[model samples]
Target: MDLETVMQELEALGKERMKKMYISNGAHEPLFGVATGAMKPFSKIIKKNQPLADELYATGNYDAMYFAGVIADPMAMTEEDFERWMDGAYFYMLSDYVVAVTLAETDIAQAVADKWIASGEELKMSAGWSCYCWLLGSRKDSEFSASKLSNMLDQVANTIHHSPERTKSAMNNFIYTVGISYLPLHEKAFETAKAVGPVEMKREKKKSSILLASENIQKELDRGRLGFKRKYVRC
Candidate 1:
């Protein structure tokens, strides 16, 4: 469908509760607050439409931007295009979930993510780390370099506590992802998580979240999910 029709459908699916939640999570006006699941049927209908996705993302509506990620053709996008998208991502949900998730599907995923990780911008760093988490959780362990991953785990152990709140959360998740999904560095990731200990992620109004990657990794291990890799990164 077209952008207008899609926006209308998304607006029709909007809910007050979800809108409030999005606002609380840093979304601004012009959003319809449609649930991500609610957009699935239309996503199937629209499939991957780079042009339409660009139009929707440019709208600056939270739900529309999210839907843009759902319909975006990652393989067709350039690093410049992804950089443009990253420029529009204003919050953790958009950066880490939408932009990073879409980037994880591309061949340039690691290259671009590396640049973003080194960007030193809060959301960019968060998205870069989160992109790694998505990649490790879905792609085969053989696709990654064990030494690089080991160094990343060391980086998390050394710097996560002092990183930005969102970056810390993503870094903690990176440790857990390496522990559970990337078998080559599981032991190293475990050691890193233990050394990192609990990470405090401060929120605007909510209580700070205590993120313990070691504990989360142990929980997954308890469930016999060690070395687990998902078939897909996005739903």
Candidate 2:
């Protein structure tokens, strides 16, 4: 489908209830409030349309950008494309989940992740951390850097308290991904989680919640989902 058709479909599917939810979760204006799941069919239809994905993202509408990630051809994307997306990404949905997951499957994933993590911007840093987590989660034990990941685990344990809210949440998710996807570090990550304590996240307006890393890890372990690597991070 074309970009205009996609936007029209998104607008048709948008709901005021979803708009309030996205806003509460830090989404900006120009959003159609289309639910993530609602974008799937459209994504599948336009999955190979790189130009369409680019056009959708360029529109700067949150829902369209969200959909762009769903349809974007990560392997075909240039570093410039990734850079533009990162620069325009202003919220966690676009930065941390959409762009991060899309890039995590690419050849330059690690390079892009390292560069973004070094950024002073909260959105960039969070996206960087999230990209790293997803890449790590999808790799085999032989390809992963245990020592480096462990060191990052230690960093989160030490500095998550002082990191930006989004960065802290990404770090917490990183730790969880590490524990759940890397058996060698599962125990160590559990220890790090206990040491780091609670990960506090700001929800809509005045609401907030704490995610207990240790508890989440334990639950995954009990469910026998530990060390299960995903084939892809998208969706």
Candidate 3:
């Protein structure tokens, strides 16, 4: 559970073996490093070794270490350290898990979300979803400033709009995370999706998100009228 052991294990799981059989031959730059997606399924085991995870995060591979941070409080990150960590920083692998943990039925989850949401970096915007999702699940009458939520949605929608089909799928998945878990933000999600337009030349699934956002909008509005919840849905 200490830092040394976790480093040893991650070192053993080098980039190649971690690739399994997937390869990218045609691109100008083929896959080179370990991806966050590859490390996610091991969350439970990762939690058991918290100190090690923090140590790894302090290294150049801080991205993956972000998973452990959200999952088990990424080591002993000082406030000053996290501020630097937020600069050009990302923990892409555990996007969904971060969303889930922030929204989870827990005691200190709001505190955890507050820490992550402190990072206003473009790359770290999904922490907005983590906070938004947490509010939806835990606070029935949650009211929040619409500006930041809309900012996150706008940035993410644009990113998904231009990404490759596969990447678009990942972005859309996160968009839906915003939808399903953040009722107060449902209209923003729906409007964002409506603005996304049909997928252009590169990635066709861009518009696929509208299907989801539209669903969430209707579902929440209908249930909301029945007193399931109430909040301002920004136009």
Candidate 4:
């Protein structure tokens, strides 16, 4: 689909309630506030249009940018394209869930994620951590190094508490990702989660509790979903 048509459709799909919710969650203006459920059918329609996704993201409209992430082919995207996407990715849903998840599917996932996590930029670092976390969910144990994973987990255990606001939240997610997705590291992740305890995040002037990594891991365990890898990081 063309950018104009997608924008028009997003406009038609948007709702005041959704817009208010996005605003409350720290999204900037120029948003259509089309719900994810509402966007799914539309996103599926454009899922293979790489050029169109690029145009949509460049528009800088919140809904369009999100749709861009939903449809873009990471394998076809250049590193420069990802950098440009990160530059405009302000909201967590856009940065972490959409951009990060899409990037995780690329051949450059590790290199990009490592660089991003180490970046001084808050959004970039958060996106990087999230990218790595989702990568764990998407890949099998045989595809990566156990020692390297352990070292990264150790690093998070030591530094997550002192990390930047969004990075801390992402780090917390990393622990949960490790706990549930990597069976051998489950004990280590549980220990790290216990060490970190509950994560505190400020949302709309209130302290919101991000689930403890151990608790989330246990929930997965109880549901018999531990060690079950996702087919893809997106969605």
Candidate 5:
């Protein structure tokens, strides 16, 4: 679908509703306010909208503004342009679409590396969380991603006891989804498992191992499950 249609379908308001739902009732206690899911396939209608995202971020609609960076392929943008977009990417963007977008087959991985450095918010920093994994996977001479790779890795490592339970579960789901596509990302996902503090991650089976999970909450979103969204939403 076209960017316009995608925007129309995945409107920030819709995401806001989901975000609110997760925060209010869905997210785990540790992850109560953190995001763990992706822009549902239904949300992918937005093909591209870096310009509009700039406008929103400029206007302080941070949620939507950050999403622009998440959806846009970093390669499609100019170096300077990407630097600017990364500047507006809200720190929390990583909790949702940003991580998936960054690790996805976007052209801006290098530019993202540059921008990741520009914004230096320490403590449970999302940029580093995924960037470290990406760096561990592949690199353009290990310069671009490796450039700021160490710093972000430190940010993620330094972050202890940051995520909650529900957030961890959702992250597990999302990471598994990301892994299904790229084997390398699977190893990178382990970074998240490690970042999740020992005390916080109660289950011995790592969060990245979804197959080993309880499978209760995922059934809510799983279409194959008897009580899918249709049945569960009604009840």
Candidate 6:
């Protein structure tokens, strides 16, 4: 479907309650607040459409931007394109979920994510770490370097306490992802999670969230989910 038709369909699916929820999570105007599950039919029809994705993303509408990621052809995108998408990602929902999830589908995911992790920007770092989480959960353990992931666990153990709130959240998730998804570094990740302990993520006008990777890992381990890998990164 074309951008206009897609946007119209998305608007028709919008819900007032979801719109308020998105606004609460940092979304602004021009969004339809279409639930993510509601977009699957559109994705099924459109499959992969780079030009339409670009158009939808450029609209700066939250629902449209999210749907863009659903239909985007990551292979057709370059580092520059990813950067551009990252630029437009105004919140964690867009950054960590949309941009990072889409990036995980590409061969260049790691290289680009590495740059963003070092960028030291709040959402960028969040997306970078989040990209790794997605990658580990979906790809084979062999796709990652054990040494590199070990070093990253060390990095989280060292810097997570001082990171920006969103970055801290992603870093915590990274430790848990490594613990459960990357088999080669599971023990090290568990150690890192223990060392990192609980992270307090301060939210704007909201209660702070206490993130404990160690506890999360243990819960998953109790469920016999260690070394778990998802079949897909995105819906």
Best by lDDT: 6
- List, residue by residue over 125-181, the lDDT tens digit for candidate 2: 899889988987898877777898888888788888878888888988988988898
List, residue by residue over 96-143, the lDDT tens digit for candidate 3: 243333233344444544555444432344443444454554455344
lDDT of every predicted structure (CA atoms): 0.93, 0.86, 0.46, 0.85, 0.40, 0.94
lDDT of 5: 0.40
Q: Which ranges of candidate 5 are over 4 A from the true structure?
A: 1-19, 22-46, 56-59, 66-71, 94-96, 103-120, 123-125, 134-235
lDDT of 1 by residue, 1-235 (tens): 8888998999999999999999999999989889999999989998999999999999999999999999999999999999999999999999999999999999999999999999999999999999999999999888998888888888888888899999999999999999999987888889888888888999998999999999999999999999788887889
lDDT of 2: 0.86
TM-score of each: 0.99, 0.94, 0.46, 0.95, 0.41, 0.99
Clashing pairs in 3: 3-52, 69-74
- Arranged by lDDT with the best first, the candidates are 6, 1, 2, 4, 3, 5
Q: Candidate 6: lDDT of 209?
A: 97
User: How does model 2 score by TM-score?
Assistant: 0.94
Candidate 4 C-alpha lDDT tens digits along 1-235: 6778889999999999999888887787899889988888877766677899889888888888888888888899989888889988987878898789889889998888888987878789899989988888889888777888889899888887677788888988888988888888888888888988887765557676565777888888899988979886777
All models, RMSD in angstroms:
0.7, 1.5, 8.5, 1.4, 11.0, 0.7
